[model samples]
Target: MTERTPFRARVHAPGAELDVQAYDFESPELIGGDDRARLDAALEAWGRQVGMLITAKTRAVVDVATAPSRIQSFGAFIASAEGPVLWATASSAGGRILYRIPLEEARYWAARMIGAAGDAAGDGAPLTSVERALARQVLTEQLAELQHATGGMFAEPVLEAFGTEPPSSVDRDAQAVVAVIGTLRRNDRRQLAAAIDAELVLQRLGAVAPHQDAAQVRTRIGGHLALAPVEIALRFDPTRVGPDTVLDLAAGDLIPLAHLADRPLVVTLDGEPVLHAAVGGNGERLACVVVSNGDLV
Candidate 1:
């Protein structure tokens, strides 16, 4: 009976938790890694989905020497239904990096998913299950779009591990988690390696034009010429015209074009003479001999 002290119970209100916010996730192990290409592709895809363009140089994983570790922040652009929203975040993935997104970025993405489901439904009403399925589909599609937008700059080997298709019932939270995990998969490592090698080859290949037969260039040039405009103009020399005497000036008098016989006509373009030819009769109409070598002007 020595322990007779009363024990008091502690109760917390619904909202009594401290408001300590967790910083954005980062991985120090990712720094100076051999799989930069896959990570880069993944980042690129993520950025694109958020309508953002980010650079690895501006971000940091962690300051290994500092207490509590710090990550650098960078700028980002987020797209919303209203327009682009701008914000910044400090990331701890590689170097000092920042992430900025629109205030409604998440909502905008959700809406896009809903819209995609609607499109897939045609005229039928979409059920909750159908909507969830569509949302997952849209998420995958949008992820691809992001990959393209970044030009494969952000690589993630993890995506290849899960294959292309995501789960059907993924919600927003699950989607985010899966996306990050997919970015970290081992298969992505090989993909990134291939991409790096390909990029290097392309860089070298772009340095010089491949040697082609002369006929090819000539053919190409001729095809280009065929698509260009051709202009033909006929010019007359004043000396070929007879003077309009007083007899020829009489009322209702018809003057014949007799001086247009056997004289060479000129063809010019932009005031530069290009050809000389004789004016001749073609049936009841007049024609010209297009001299190939003479100057027209």
Candidate 2:
């Protein structure tokens, strides 16, 4: 110790140690791989339609691409959205979901619509009244494409509202299948993301396959109907009679009907006409020979 002349033996500490991060929390919710893959396929089809719509509307060739999707809470998705974005809210059978595109993208559409310089877009400025009008029109049309794209995923999804600011109606905690859509950007292509309800899609896919054969559906319906019994009525045109004629009805009284002889009569089920038939005999039992058949009303 005497040899250490006025020197301090100090252990230099590396400040306060941060608590070691460990796998201490439950994993976030996510759709399974197979389901996610199926969803992606459906979304890819939708992107193709959108591209066609834009190309048709603008008379310009624009390709649309779908990026690999992400699963996260709507809150996270909304918060992470950078810069000004126009959000179009759509109410579906699942729930109210959001569709978002950068305001710059909206301006791009507006520019093309108004026959302005399409190359000069995204000035990082708010849309004027006229620009907003044009943006709204294109977005409304886009939502129609969304309807066709999702099929029955959304039922009559009327565009409720749209603006640069996020509406308070969105559920913050709801997990979403956020899709990144890339189309006609000022810089060439935009990767705008929109949140779709994961629960809705999973539940729908779990219930029904994306494709169903029409013939198979008809056969299924026919099989079900064959086992069901229904009361059927044969009718010709009604004979108009006074109330006195009804009250004075007698046994074996003849009343002429409007039906012509040898012509097919209307066969009805539950008061709606569904078939044409002619009176006939089947092994001594009276029967109606079906001449034509149709769907029940």
Candidate 3:
């Protein structure tokens, strides 16, 4: 071995074995796919019902989208009948849930209800005395529908407070928001969006204690799951084919299934056979009635 050459020691601190900046472990809770789907359907119903109650001609279609957790600072603002960035906090089993909407959209709806030619530009100004009365009535009706739709998931959600002003103090990084994109149409087009903070929506599903409300919640969840939405796939008989055969198939080629055309189809949920149903039609629509229960596994 030759004599080793001298080396300069590292004057600065050595690089860290683990990159502290890159190490991130915080996983803020979020609703799962099933719950998200359920909420989407419920909110769509809520939007449709609001449209029917507000005006027969004006329709509002809302699409629900998931929003990631974020921090928000509340600031004072004015309220409008249609929407002036309204905020409402409701107490739930997990904690408090916050709902928000833009005032312009709310005003647009109010205008339609009153059959008035409202201004195109709604600045979210405080509604006039008459407008405020109409707006509050509509708001209460919509809120009641929302409470009914979400009754199965959330606790008895009573409207705790409502104002144009944002909360004075809130946790810096606490809110988890869900977005609702709405389209209002009455000859002219208008778009609006609202958000709801559902921090405890998913958590409360499984949080069971001996408390009165908790006990009721648990009982309700057990009964509600049967009504939960599920995909009922209609599967024909399987015909196993080799990879080479699959690769050589073309559009016109027919791969005959193992069963006859009249055979009952296998209805599956989550990839497990749940029922056997015979395929048929019911006046311009495809329909199926259960023939028997399939072996579930």
TM-score of each: 0.27, 0.56, 0.45
C-alpha RMSD in Å of predicted model 2 compared with the true structure: 29.5
Off by over 4 Å in 3: 1-29, 56-84, 169-172, 186-199, 207-297
lDDT of 1: 0.34
The TM-score ranking, best first, is 2, 3, 1
- Residue 209 displacement in candidate 3 (angstroms): 12
Between prediction 2 and prediction 3, which has the larger TM-score? 2
**lDDT by residue for model 2 (1-297), tens:** 445223122222336454434432222435557766777776777677777877766667877789877777788888888878898887767566688888877786777777876676466888999989988887777667666786655454567888988878888888777878788633486666768776766666673345778999997887765545445677886678889988988999988776678668888775888788888887966778888765532
lDDT of each model, Cα atoms only? 0.34, 0.72, 0.54
Model 2 has an lDDT value of 0.72
Model 1 regions lying over 4 Å from their true place: 1-47, 50-215, 238-262, 269-271, 283-285, 295-297
Which candidate, 2 or 3, would have the higher lDDT against the true structure?
2
**Best lDDT goes to which candidate?**
2
What's the true lDDT of residue 112 in model 3? 70
RMSD to the true structure for each prediction, in A, is 31.0, 29.5, 23.1
Q: List the residue pairs that clash in candidate 2.
A: none
Error of 2 at 134 (Å): 1.9
